[model samples]
Target chain A: MTGAACVLGVDSGGSGLRAALGSPEGAPCAGPVRSAEPVRTGPRGIDAGHFMDLLLPLARDLLAASGGGRIAAVAVGAAGMATLGEGLRAELPGALGRELGAERVALAADAVTAYAGALGERPGAVVAAGTGLIAVGTDLAAWRRADGWGHLLGDCGSGAWIGRAGLEAAMRAHDGRRGGSPALRDRAEKVFGPAAGLPGQLYPRADRPAVLASFAPEVAACAAGDAVAGGILRDAARHVAEAAAAVCPRDAASEVALTGGLIKLGEPLLGPLRDDLAELLPHARQVPAAGDPLDGALRIAGGLAADRLLLPRDARMLSVHRSEGPSTSA
Target chain B: MTGAACVLGVDSGGSGLRAALGSPEGAPCAGPVRSAEPVRTGPRGIDAGHFMDLLLPLARDLLAASGGGRIAAVAVGAAGMATLGEGLRAELPGALGRELGAERVALAADAVTAYAGALGERPGAVVAAGTGLIAVGTDLAAWRRADGWGHLLGDCGSGAWIGRAGLEAAMRAHDGRRGGSPALRDRAEKVFGPAAGLPGQLYPRADRPAVLASFAPEVAACAAGDAVAGGILRDAARHVAEAAAAVCPRDAASEVALTGGLIKLGEPLLGPLRDDLAELLPHARQVPAAGDPLDGALRIAGGLAADRLLLPRDARMLSVHRSEGPSTSA
Candidate 1:
């Protein structure tokens, strides 16, 4: 009954939000996800009430679609919480809290889930380069984080980074500083205006990340022909590879997983990333994650991979737990 | 007699503001200037009201000190207006508009004035690497600009940029990702707090530019020993030099003028800048500006170097003028 007690997983990302329902071994149901902000639990602080308000609706929608059967467990993989653990535990603001059953709900950062989904709780690094970029790695001895210092400081090889680089190059070309693609110019004009007044057109806008991300595809498309765009993609790849290498180190690594929207750019981004990874860290091989972060979330929720969670030992209670139905008799 | 046809020069910079009153020949009387914003006219757009408020008092004070001299002309050299020859004419919100006689006043961008002050109307590139960085060069035939893309996109060699890099390095160090100076952490703590949470402690601050700029000295000081800090400074120098090289091409060069508060850090910034310029553009040699931006502004106002003024052909009337008494014959 109820397909042997299915598990639910949620991914809260900058680009979109997705909920996965069903057994990890079977075809999980996901999607019609909404793009929204991740959990706001940090030094600036998170609001648990607000977090529940945003998540419950999405969860209920998924549950309603699941044949109205009994629910087993729930897991969440969120960007804000994704490499959380280290010193960030005490500062975490009741992440996911007891809004659900409190016993069957588990919360892990997006990187951990990506790691679990990609490498199955193994020791290695995983780079999630989407609208944002961050590389989190564990060699089972030391934890290392590379880049993902947000969009302003580092985030070297992210889609946003690539988009920004492309836009800057386009602006430079327009200002007669360099040669750029007309198509690139068109893309800029489409978003930033035909006058090409970049700073005025870009900085003040609230959706700067999204605006920049929209240009990422243009950069990837232009990489085949345009030198500037091509160069940007190559640089992005190098940065991404370097980030992965920064975490994995020499002796304690195996698989480096590359995930997120930018990975879907295919050859333009991956080709160079792979080349750079070989040069930067030969021991760690780049591998496709075996499952989505949702799968990793499910694994953590179902107690299938509890050890895979990356929280500090004192803060295992940080994950939210909820239980229901005959399968997970909490 | 109102001081025998004197002119006023204003230097509005990231660090402080200065107004000069003296004859056109020698160094004009300057200082007691408040650090303030420049002309409010750029693609990203800037505010000039703050500049006027800060300047009017300084100008009034200088006028008072001048013993009521006949102000023949006034010139302003401001960062915001440094590259403002484009579509920012009508939008300039009363920079020297009515605070003084608008006609006799000549407003030139800081980079052009920097070029004049350093090279005296000579065809060359001038790099202003203060809290903000922008390089403008004139080959007598065409005008070219490099970098100065603002803190978000470019301004690669600027003090603000360097400080940001240094802070990022500090964050990495605190996170156990990299080795950094305890002094660096101390500086960050002083500014951001002992919590040392970067983005949360930072991004929301109102005076981010000033805060970032304050760390530049620490970066310069650490250049001699700390690898990370040293790396940041070297990169800064290279970027600054590259900006100069970008604007001033090979054949059309006179000399590259390096001027700014950051330049005061001496060889740490200048050494690598010179080296990079040598490699990047062999024709350009680094030189100290012949005079300060005040001198350049004076030159522009007295119309001694009208061609040096980097304003649109149609709207050179942005500068302010106040004439009285016998010398000016107003």
Candidate 2:
């Protein structure tokens, strides 16, 4: 006989996609498969066809390796899903049902999954910072978000924001202007070549945010000795905390967590970030993230399979679709 | 005598190309012929072939329209000439000599031309604030520039910068975050459709800087009653003045001038800009621009033709190339 039914969870982000298989009890089963290439987004938002193409083979491999079981439910957490998820919401459910025999599917914004993974249906806020930064909160009632405006208009305290600022300081140093950092200039020239050619190097690329974010680590590396670089991180920290405070629940009992690749910048970013968060959101209890976005996706999948989901649903942030029949069993 | 040996002057910018014919005495002789499309730039930097294709026909048309003057000299001022001008510097002199029978050619950064138009080789700074912001100064020795790093990195206090700040405020209002402007939000939604669709509309376009700059006037328009919008402009003025201060010569008699399309925003921008300029550049005299960039190009061409060009030569900022042999006369 085939193994017990399993749930599939996938987290798609700027770095790539991560998928895991889990039991209804939230225990990991087969594989947390990863693909380093992010799913492409197009005119229709998240390209459902491209997503399925990347996903189905991996799902099949996970299922086969785990002794072949029916997919009871599936959950996908994706970047840009809040604004650009029309394609995924409309097509993912039917496609999942047809291909994986999933009777329940949850489509969620990556922030929502980040929240689920970090706090697990609790009433609080979670700041997800990577190439971009966003804060999502739930009093277990409705979702609130701030920032995540991409590299152009906002994402103020994000990796891209820090990298762009660092590069700007480098350019200023090159031009012999005030507020420049020679240390950051050296780092930037080492990384991106001469400061004069930076605009030509950066502006044309379609993946400009990622390209900009790639330099964030360099900024962090220079922060210890360079006042300008350190100032950039402090300002970045303030913005990040402000974003979190914007979306964090005001209740004293609420918890806040910080997650994502930016935390890897470590103490230079985190030190000011902690101070800012304390000053900005005094009522909330700061906490460590319990898990990652893929784990959150898995948790949501397991919750959907078990009919125990407690997170609030929103049309864009988190939407659930059900197959119009009784639950399938292995 | 073919119209007393007139010179050719061309201004290539974000808006388009504008060409004029002038006598060696710096008086206009023929049409300021316009081409609505800006010359295309490529990986090799400021496509020389495309520039020639656009300019040759226009030069011929201007010559025919003005009774066929001998092109004694040609000067072309282009937007990215300070950096992305290798292609132009390499091929323009030879081509202009062969096609228009021009013996002298001056290729200048648009800011250099703007300075020539505004202050005319004097010891002062000129802040050229248009779609992008750049301040160029000269003590009649060498050019000093601040900002002009393009829309992505710097260009602080630029049209694009102001418009981006306005849009960010609009997005903040949409997200119900602090520092949001509902007035700006209403304006943005009207101009760009729903708040949610902005990233989709903007980030893909190659002309993002121009698109962002298109809203700067709206920001200026709302500054009268809206504090957030007003704040944005005030900050813009500060940045503009800061750029000017960064490049301005620290001499008691040095002059400063403001030039470019952004001047049309009127007193709302100018009021604060005046305050900041007066405070930051107290040593320099403030002056109105005598003419636009096309006039500056014409002046440079005239100067080149008469062998009286006084501006310092820089390989990237203001390069001049002369043909071998004696000067060709009409």
Candidate 3:
């Protein structure tokens, strides 16, 4: 008889992708048990085939490490998979099935796993703002989404958005259309190049984050005085709070869980966001994403097996007695 | 006797410093009116003695190039010399005298020169936003004022300020404080780096345009649907217009001239700034700067010898010739 079976959960992040495997007890059966990988999924779009190619081997390695030598179920969360739809979903499981011959594969939005990670199997909202911003939640039926319109349309409160705003401000200052902020101007130039000396070639080839994220520290630096940076943060916080409020369950007390690359930078942004949320949504509780999203995905994986999403025999076979295994973490 | 003596006007720019001999007709003389030299002043602050080093060579070159070996007059409109006061006035001429002998040197703020170039000795406000920003006007006397507070404090409507604001907005969104704008987010990541990634390592070492300038196009892209970038730009334009209004002289019918890299990037910022100015200062006339700040500086060089503070004969000769010298267009 197979021991305690486990489910694997995978999360693709900005810096890297993580995987985790766990049992019903919320205990890990195998690995998380991995680090992040940098895959450039930008406006140009990720090569779904290439992404699958990269992931299957990792999954196989994770499964081999599991004691049961098999993963009963698998769920993955990705960063820029907007157009993936069923085609991408099918490719995920099909690749895994061909590699390990696993029993079942469930594919959901990265936000779903993040939501599960934050709520730990319960219903809640997860707003991930990194290179992009997507606010997601779960109700009795389908997953609910308030925003995530891509860079051109939606995603008001995101690192990319804020960074862009800061850069624009810097440019305005540089151009004299705006006044001047020494700290901001200094910060941008320090990161990219001398404002006055930027080469025509460099402007077109300039990377987004290399130039945009450079101003983040300046924003915090100037938060004490630079009204433009401060105002941007304040306004962003209001918009984010509004987004979370939009999908938050009307009846029950909503737990708004925030995650992603931006929050880690710390204060000015955090303080204002918190204050703004409190003012905007009295009933909702604002909190930092508990652990990494991978953990949430793992919990979801465990819960799925425990809650009869998988056959009891399959669960048993995939769980327990593991030296190492496929990841279950969100 | 001396091959038709001439004056040289040197306008120090962000890309490099340009030395020119302008005729009274407002044309540059000789070959290569402008040449590449390192930008001496920026938000980060000036080089230790870079100012003197740049000015000295510029003057010597002008003398050597002039058929009128005896430069009649020397007029200089240097950027960031506002705080230098008479000390700059004294030091610049003194430095030139060391090179070509202490005959005549007419030095003034680059802002004044820009005024002459754009308004042709008329009274108006010239707002220059390059890597930094300042608003200057030509009244009966030379007027100088610092608008944007070096990218740290002021700079209401500058690129750096806008970029900083956009980044802050992203962070707020990450914290569940605000909504998200994908355009801003994608642009930030492209310009700066992945959200919350290792910022210290990711940021460029030199002062660069805010990452947001990269995404500024996105703001315009999303303006039809995105409220965040649009709102940010609208507010930025309004704020910048306010600064211009504050600096424009009350005595004359205020003609606000817009000049900067941000404006060249296209709409979002420019259109909104123009609209905001119209709303803020109905009486003020908005006009595109007739030429770049360097041109303005050249104009100042010509004017200083002819009008305003007087210069010696040789200095005046240099000015008229420099104005007619070969320019970038030539």
Candidate 4:
């Protein structure tokens, strides 16, 4: 069934989900895709079926706007898909077919799409560092991940990780338990002011990692030679390098592609991370992602259609299915 | 004139001003001295004259409870005054004489008492690390200070400084700009919740630094082996050592004392700081204050009266000044 074939891609994260349609170049679809309220993914991330339930109606609305033309395919790249394995892989395709009346559905981790978008569905690794840090790689059909231990046990090379480190320094400096770096001390007081005392006030609520993660750039400035702040960046880079190395598979063609907010520390962190990773994996190739993860998902859909492994409408339907597959209301 | 004479020591921080009366053995005076709202010192750390203005009346109140007997003499060690010259120092005596009707008033920086509290008023240095940091030394009639830059330019080894450092690290981690310790991020999320993403909420509040400062122990913990956190503490300890060495005149004769909330980091920071200082000045002496700074002030007052410099009624009037000075006005 192919009539003005359409494809949809959705990228959901801790805060919200973003969906787009059309070709890999960010071309607009013939119709509109509906959006819904942001659902709290919790500490473990979002549930796939529940995510599909939320997205299906929105996908239908978009397809219905296509003036009665059948949707070709649907694909989704979401934040929490890494936590799901084979037992859950079929959940998405089944839900999308049932909910959106689609002919074909493609299920893959958001990291897969991110990898695809950044370097196309090729052989490489993607470091998805947002509120947290996780390194993912694809060796054709096999997928591997490392360092997504949330904000507590792991996530050494993430925004949250850096933020948490910064907070500890500030606390020590503020109490005079430790001598403070001029740069780090200045940034904390500039943002929080002098009256910011009392340990409990530093974290009266939850989601502190996100709060601390917000100051990543400030630390970058310090790391760029501001004596007090430079160490923070230097240390953070080391953590990221460890994470990337942890996920690199032995005897695989490893092309490391960096993603996420923490890389903004630029040279101070990135340069060191590169040097360290090279020391560990002498033959590891560093690849920069060209586009976002959703684009990678779309590219995958396009390639499938081109290869006839999936039909044009099948690809379009799969794309639409991805947008609506996570929240399939039970 | 002397009817069971007692000494009262007052410590005024940004949070609150508390007065305590007791002996060097840690026994409470016949009655509690007094306490009041935190007097705004206005950054440059409260001038000697202004301190007298607020303190004299409080002294009188405390003295009045002595029941018409002498308070022996009054000694006040404030956060500032170490940098004040003879002219500024003279004004304090006049202010106390006129305001509280005292014959003797000894005005100096809390560093003096902090040091004395740590080393019994002998020649030594006290690292006064509270909301701010000050390294002070005393040699007979002269006093010297260094590294108490308040919250703005200096305060290298202070609670405010550490809090600021932690915040910057967390921000970098949040934005994915750098990897950081897991502390500030988690702590911040706990304090601010969803609003933790909003940096403004973590700053410029009464409890921000106080809350952040509470993590001094964490910095110490991390410094012991927490990698990212250890770096923060080591950096701070170095700063504190530099500040201490800078203020202490002769390294051979200098006794370094540690005070303030930062000291709670215990041996983690202190041990490293001592080692660092040893490298800078092998003969530099280190010790914890025998008690709080206010207690040292009382001891100084007792010593002054024992030497017959102040009449008995002078002490009584100082007590009256603290308790009845404000109320007698209207």
What's the TM-score of each model vs. the native?
0.80, 0.94, 0.56, 0.56
| Residue A80 miss distance in model 1 (angstroms) | 1.7
Model 3 chain B TM at 0.77
Runs in model 4 with CA error above 4 Å?
A1-7, A14-16, A22-116, A119-124, A130-132, A137-236, A262-270, A296-330, B1-5, B10-19, B23-116, B119-125, B128-243, B246-253, B260-272, B297-330
Docking class of predicted structure 4? incorrect
Which residue segments of model 3 deviate by more than 4 Å? Answer: A1-4, A24-27, A39-45, A84-87, A147-155, A160-207, A214-218, A221-233, A265-267, A303-330, B1-117, B127-237, B242-255, B258-330
CAPRI tier of model 1: acceptable
Clash number for every model? 22, 0, 162, 130
lDDT of 3 by residue, B1-330 (tens): 255555566676556777766564346675334546754543434442566676566665665676545444565666554443334443555455555442455555565566555655555566666445566654444453435444433455566656655654554444344445665666666665665541332243355344434444555555556688778778767766766665566654667776766575468778877787777667677777777655555555555555553222222112222222222113
| Better-scoring candidate (TM-score), 2 or 4 | 2
Best by lDDT: 2
Position A36, candidate 2: lDDT: 86
Rank by lDDT (best first): 2, 1, 4, 3
Over the full model, what C-alpha lDDT does candidate 2 score relative to the true structure? 0.88
Ranked candidates (DockQ, high to low): 2, 1, 3, 4
Better of 2 and 3 by lDDT: 2
Per candidate, native contacts kept equal 0.21, 0.59, 0.04, 0.00
Where's the lowest-lDDT run of ten residues in candidate 3 chain A? A311-320
lDDT, candidate 2, at B95: 81
- RMSD after CA superposition, every candidate: 5.3, 2.5, 10.8, 10.4
